[model samples]
Target: MTAADFQIDDREGGSVLRLTGDWTTTGLGSGARDLQARLGEGRVTALDVSELGRFDTAGALTLVQATTEALPKDAWASRPEAGRIYAMVETLERQSAPPPRRPDALTRTFAKIGRGVFDIGHEMLLSMAFLGRLTTATGGALRRPGSIRWPAWFSQGERAGLDAMPIVAVTNFFIGAVIAFLGANLLTQFGAGVFTVQLVAVATLRELAVLITAILLAGRSASSFAAEIGSMRMNQEVDAMQVMGVNPFQALVIPRLAAMIIMLPLLTFIGMLAGFLGGMLVTWSQLSYGPSFFIQRISEDPMMGTHLMVGMVKAPVFAVVIAAIGCRQGMSVAGDVESLGRRVTAAVVQAIFAIILLDAVFALIFLELNL
Candidate 1:
């Protein structure tokens, strides 16, 4: 192939650029750059591509870029092929150019909000779809109990429930103590310090214990589930399971869901006992009310059992939300460490938010029912 070359000759009106030899990518070499530099020295009024041997898009782009002004319609009339290629390049350049003006602040802000709303709606749809699939898998497992992975269920239960007891108990205990202390201080002003026992019992049994336990699990087990399953997804292990005809929901998600279902209620019960103990101790220290007095006061309250029942009933529901959100986020992970990290963080945040939202719903329902 002949090497590409260009010549600039002064003409009557202005300069004329004459492109010659093979203008294909392999023949252009430094000739393209040299042509652009030469064209920058003077305005070229006309293009002469009649001698552009073996021309291609590369040469067309170079010629188009070298000329600041648009080429005349007949500039490449002799080389119709070059005219077509040049037109194609020019069209692409026009299409790829940036927008003329940036959006204003108000427009940008609204766009961002719109995107956030859209993302939230999309996420809700995805989560609902995942839940549907999970339900189907669970039904299948129930039909064939032999396919259930008991060891995994037990292992997850121990990790998420038994191992999490200390932190759950400690947090609830302190919360209860604080509530009792506040009640004693405030109630004493009304000459009703003895009512502190009833306050502690009702609060601990109806809301604080279960709420705190669920929040703890949201931070703890939810992140763990997301990370574990997310790592599997990243490593393509989930895909392998699918290839082997294994239901990822049954093998991975169901066990974790089952564990959470079985363990959270048990943990919440433990948390309630710990909170009661803390409240009793605080009441004793602050009001000179012994543990027996605290117990007697709580036991005598007709609504205490109802409060406990309300709290316990929320446990399983909260557990399901936490497990489902975590596993769903994990399944959505891309095959990258960054995606795994992001999904894990999202799992914890989403779980906690859902827990709070559901708790509010439960509270409203119980209030309406006069429970």
Candidate 2:
């Protein structure tokens, strides 16, 4: 093997390139690469390869790359034997066309927005379809009450609702305390520090308790449902159930949905009490207001019932959204660990978004109602 020779002969037009030596890996690969770079600029209009010594795939690739770079003109090997190797590489290259270049930033941004809108619409349709299926399953169960799985309902309720009590309680407690502290801090500036107790009670009972609890459940129970069902799907257990003349919707999904629907309100009620208790603690510690005064203040507030009712009413909807999204994503999981993980994550994201969207809609409705 000898060193690669890249001799350029300038003419009135462009130039002629004489590619000599081995051009193989054992030969001057560095020289070939350098030659490739020099010839890449479209300066070489012709190629001569009669003197090309040792040849291999490596040599063929280097030559192929060079000749490809020499566009608007063909770079033919002077010797016929080497022409076959070049032709083979050229054929392969031609068969596999280069990918199109990435779109510009502006085009990509618009495309991304369009895709996002489409995805939202698609998911909404899927969710509605899933809801319809679930409703049908529920109606079937109602017709034959004995077919309803009470054990599964109890088990799911325990896992999703009962087991989540401590975290929900403690979390809302602190949240309430923080809200009271903030209210006191701000209202004190206007000589309305006493209204801090009112603020905590209203917010805790009306919005904070239910909203935070739903968010927690979305992260916790929703993820659990997605993972559990997703795993079953991955293992083909869901498929096995269907094969056995069993309804996955009744056995797997309905119980979870019922549990969430049942548990969310219960949890919300628990959370509201906890938050109010926390606010009570903060009120007493920070402002020296006693429990009796706090209780009396809450009783005197006319909007308290309206606010409490408003927040509680949203729980069932939030529950259905969260459970449905979790189950839907789970059912959609492909037979792979990565797919399961991805679906579980998507379930959480979609559940949270739905919860927030529902809350905002509730707020608007209540605002219009003047509640």
Candidate 3:
């Protein structure tokens, strides 16, 4: 068969190659090689194929191969036909290439941990800035208490506090029971069974109650805060609030921060109570410790009150951490559902890390204080 007739038309600022009639394999290959030479020499910046083109896959592959071999770097190919051909060739090449080597498990885990630490640090810095803004807004509101948005506060409290109680209660109860059981078993072996009461009280009131409650709040309340604020951000509701002469931080963030601040301590208190009860049940049934005996042990323990106070203090700080981290991440969320999910996850993770770190600091302080 005769080769297809074609012509190369050079245009100002670019080059256009027009083809007419059928393109034989020989003609297509030769054309591709010639185009490749021109492209390699930087003589052609753009290729145009708007006229008289009838080409098969072979013809298309010729142009793709030419471009792939000629292009000095990954530059944009503007011609539709060339782009399409390039994409096809790329897909085929990728499929034909060997599978990528997998990283070692330890290496992957450390990489993930490094990323998590970086994310937490970034989130904490942003959270500190958000907290500063919140402090300013709170002081302003205090100057005019009526300026505080009570309705928003109540709504957020209902969502973040009341809605989260069941899970928090269950988790705290189980944690308390587990700690009590473990402590009783170990202490009983050493003939220190009576001290189990003190152990349960100190562990639950000073550490487990605060730690478990903070974790639950981080996962539930903090994530919820991030998601809610992120959704508002994604929907441009935050921007709309600004346009309506309302501060987005005041209207969107203040209420959440307030709700969490007020609610988390209450939640922690409730969790402590539930956990104590769970421990009491274990003590009575498993350890033969009566209610009076347990009560006496707690009252006689010199550090019991101090432990309780420490846990309560930690609750408020943990609440602030969760709320601040959540709101900061939400405010930073981009306008997409995926970003919302990611920020929410990041908020919870960061809040947990902060809570644990803060708890450790408190533990060290109390230890030094002989409490």
| Residue pairs in clash, model 1 | none
Q: Candidate 2 on 217-283: residue-level lDDT in tens?
A: 9999889999999999989999999999999999999999999999999999999999999999988
Model 1, span 40-62: residue lDDT tens: 75677887877779888888788
* Window of ten residues with lowest summed lDDT in model 2: 69-78
- State the weakest 10-residue window (summed lDDT) of model 3: 69-78
Model 1 whole-model lDDT (C-alpha atoms):
0.92
The residue-by-residue lDDT of candidate 3 on 6-58, one tens digit each, is 45556676554454544435545454457556645334454444443455556
> Against the true structure, what is each candidate's TM-score?
0.75, 0.85, 0.71
Per-residue lDDT, model 2, residue 123, is 77
Residue 251 CA displacement from its true place in model 2, Å: 0.5
Give the count of colliding residue pairs in each prediction: 0, 0, 0
Indicate whether candidate 1 or candidate 3 has the larger lDDT. Answer: 1
- Ranking by lDDT, best first? 1, 2, 3
Which residue ranges in model 3 land beyond 4 Å of their true spot? 1-54, 57-125
User: Clash number for model 2?
Assistant: 0
